[model samples]
Target: MLKAAGMLGAEMSTTRVLLALLLTSAGLRRSSQEEIAEQQDSSLITSLLETYSAVQMPNNGSMPLRVSILISVSNVMDVDILQYTISSVLMLNQSWYDYRLRWNETQYPHHSITVPLETVWTPSFSIREAHTVETKDLSPKVKLHSSGWVQHILGLRVDSNCNFELFRYPEDDTDCQLTFSSLLDTELAFEVSYVNEIENVKHEYLVTTLDARTSHGPGPPSFSLTLHLQHTPSKTVLSLIVPSFAVLIADVFGFMLPILGNERISYKVTLLLGYLVFHSSLVNGLPGSSSCNPLLIHLFLSILTLLFISMIETIFVTRIASEDLPSWMSRILWTHYTPGNQNTGDDGKRIEAEEDRVTEPRSAQEMEQRRQKLAAGLDRGFTIVYVSFLLLFYAGFAGTWFLMECHTEARPRPRPGF
Candidate 1:
C-alpha cells in the first residue's frame, strides 16, 4: 500500500511540471509579440549576411521543402525566333519560410508578407524551355503567407520555343508549349508539385489544346507544367490568303483583254510586279524558318512562271502576225471565216467558197483573203492557249493546296531543351 501511494505522488508531480512548462512558454510567446511581428520587415541585407553562418547543421536540402506551385497565365504574346512569349503570376505554398515568423494570428493580422524569393529557402525550380536572354527578370517578390503559402505576381515574358511546319501554312494550326521546372534543387532537398491539376490560362487568343503537369523522378526531381496552345490561323488567312486571291483574280481577268496591241503585255507585267512587291512585304512579316514550303512562296513562284511564259507567248504570236503565212496554211486555219459561194446572192465581201484550196490560188482576191485570215487565226490561237493554260494551272494548284491542308499530320509539340 505504501509503494502504491509513492507511485501516485510521482505521477502527480510529473503532470504538475508539464503544466508549469506550458504556462511559462505561453507567457514568453506573448511577451515576444512585437519581436515576432517585426520579422516581416527583416532586412534582406541582414538575411544575406547571416545566410552563410554555421548553425551546426548542414542546410543543403536536409529538410526537403514542400513547394506547391500554381500558375495563372494572364497574357500570351506573339511568336518570335520560333518561340511563344507568355506572361503569368505564380502562387507558391512553401512551409520553410512560414513558421519563421509565426505569432498570434489576431495581433498583426497580416496573412501575407512580401519578401524577395531568394531570401527564403531556394526550391528546385526554374522556367524550363525559357529562351535564354542576357537580362532575365528573376527578382520577383514572393508574398509569403502565415500558413506557408507564397504568391508572386511577376511578368517574366518567357519566350518558349515552338516548332512550326509551313507545308500547309496560312491554313495550319500552331501548337506552342509552356513548361515550368526546377533545376537547382535535388529531389531530396525539395518536393516540387503543382497546386492545380490543370494549367490556368486566359482564353482570349490561343486555344488551350493540352494542359498538364508531369514529373518523373526518384533522383533529382523536376516539376513540369506543359500547355499546348493551338493557333486558329485567322490572322494569316485574312492577311495573306485573302489579299493573294484578290491579286490572282486580277491576273486571271487580264486574259480577257483583247490582244490587238500592248494592253495584254502591260497588264501581265504590272500584275507580276505587284505580286513581287506583295510577296516581299509578306516575307518580312512571316517567321524566318524554312521547315516546310510556304503557301505564299509556292503560289508566288507559280504566278511568276506563268507571267514569264505569257510574255514569251505574246512575243511569239506578234511575230507570227507580222510575218506572211503560206496560202494553204492560212486557209486551213481560217476555215470558219471562208466566204459562201458567189453567184448565189452572196455579198461583195463573200466572193467564193474555195474548196479547201485544192490548188494554190495566185489571184489578188485570194492573196488578200489569206492575209486577213492569218491575222484572225493568230489572235484566236493566242486567246485559246492563254485561257486553257491558266485554267489547267489553276486546277492543279488548287488540288495540291487542298491536299496539303487536308492530309493527316501529327500535331507539332514543342521540343524541350536549354
Candidate 2:
C-alpha cells in the first residue's frame, strides 16, 4: 500500500511540471511585437508628455530667464551677417523640477528630454534690431542641472541689418550691437540682463562687450548688448596704407626721370593707372555707412587730383622745353641785370638804344638762345615748386592719417562726456 502511494505522488509531480511548461509557452506567444510596442508608447507618453511635463506653466508666477553669451566670430559676411557660434546658456526654473515634485520621484527615468516651447505662457526672446537669425546648429541642447536651473546651449548665425559708421575706414573701430530682449515681454514682463560672457574671438577682431542701454520707445521694448569691435589695423596698413604711400613715392620719383622721351610720361601714366586699380580694390574693402564721405575717401581723392595735376604739368613743361619760346615767355624769362640807366648824355649810347628798338624781331639764332634760357629757367623753377608741393601734400596725407587714428582711439576711450 506505501509503494503504490509513492508511485501516485511521483506521477502527480510530473503532471504539474508539464502543465507549467505549457502555460509559459502560451504566455510568450500571446506577448506579440505589436503589443510590446503599444505598451512602450503608452508608458513614455503618459510619463513624459500627457501627464506632467508639457504644460505652459506648472507654477503660477513668471519665470525669470537670465542670458549670457560665449561668442566665437568665425566669419563676418558681406551682407552684414555675423556667422558665429554662440554658446548661450539661459538660466531659469527647470520645468522637470515641477514634474518630479508632482510625481514624487527620486530620479528622472531618462537623463534628459527636449521640450519644444511654442507661443505659450513663457515669453520668447530675440536679438533687438536683428533682421533675421539663421540657425546653423540643428537643435538646441537641453539639460536639467542639479542646481535646479535648466541650461540651454545653442549655436546661431545671426543676420543683423546694422548701419555701420566707417568715418575712419580700414582703421575703423565700431560698436555693433547684438541686443537680446524678449520679443513679447518688453520691460513690463521680464528684466533682461547680460551676464558678462566669455569670448573666444579672432585676432583681427577685438571683441568686447559695451555698457547696456535700454531701447525704450513705442515699438517692441528692447535692450542692447553692444559688441565693441576694434579692427586690428595691422593688416589694413600692410594691404592698403603702406602700399599707397609707396606708390605715391614711386610716382614722385617718376618726375625726376629725364623728360626727353615718352618714357617719363608713359611710366607716370602706368603708375597712376596702377593706383587707380588699387583704389577700386580699396573701395570694395571699405566698410559701408549711411554717410557718404569718409576721411580716407577725402584723402584719396586729394591724392588722385595731385597726381593728375603733376602729370599734366610734366607734359606742359616738357613741351615748352622742346618748342620755341613764345614772345611772352622770352620777355618774362630774360632778365639781363642792369645798373639803372645812367644819364651819361653820350650820343653813341643813345644811338645804340634807338637802333635796338628799330631792329627786326630777333634772328633765329637769338630766338634759339632765348628758348634755351627759358627751358633752363623752367627746370630750376619747376624743381622748387614740385618739391614744395610734394612736401606739403605728403605732410598733409600723413598728418590726416594720424589724426584719424587719434580720433578713432579717443572716441572709444572712457571719457566723462561718454
Model 2 over residues 1-418: C-alpha lDDT tens digits? Answer: 9999999999999999999999988887777755775675455435554544333443524653333333344444433312222222222221223333222124433333444432112334576445556655464445533333444444455655443445666566666665555554443323344444445344565555545565556665555556566666787778877887787778778767866567878887887788888888876666443343456766666667667776786676666565455766545444331222333567757865776655434533455555556555776677679778878977887787566443222112111110
Clashing pairs in 2: none
Tens-digit lDDT track for model 1 on 32-119? Answer: 9757667634543344335433222123245554554444444455545233344433344433443443434465466666666555
Return the TM-score for each candidate structure. 0.60, 0.62
lDDT of 2: 0.54
- Candidate 2 positional error at 381, Å: 2.9
Candidate closest to the true structure, highest TM-score? 2
List residue ranges in candidate 1 displaced over 4 A. Answer: 1-65, 81-115, 132-155, 188-210, 217-220, 230-239, 288-290, 323-399, 405-418
Clashes of 1: 1
Point out the worst 10-residue segment of candidate 2 by lDDT: 409-418
What C-alpha lDDT do the candidate models reach, one value each? 0.55, 0.54
lDDT score at residue 275, model 2, on the 0-100 scale: 81
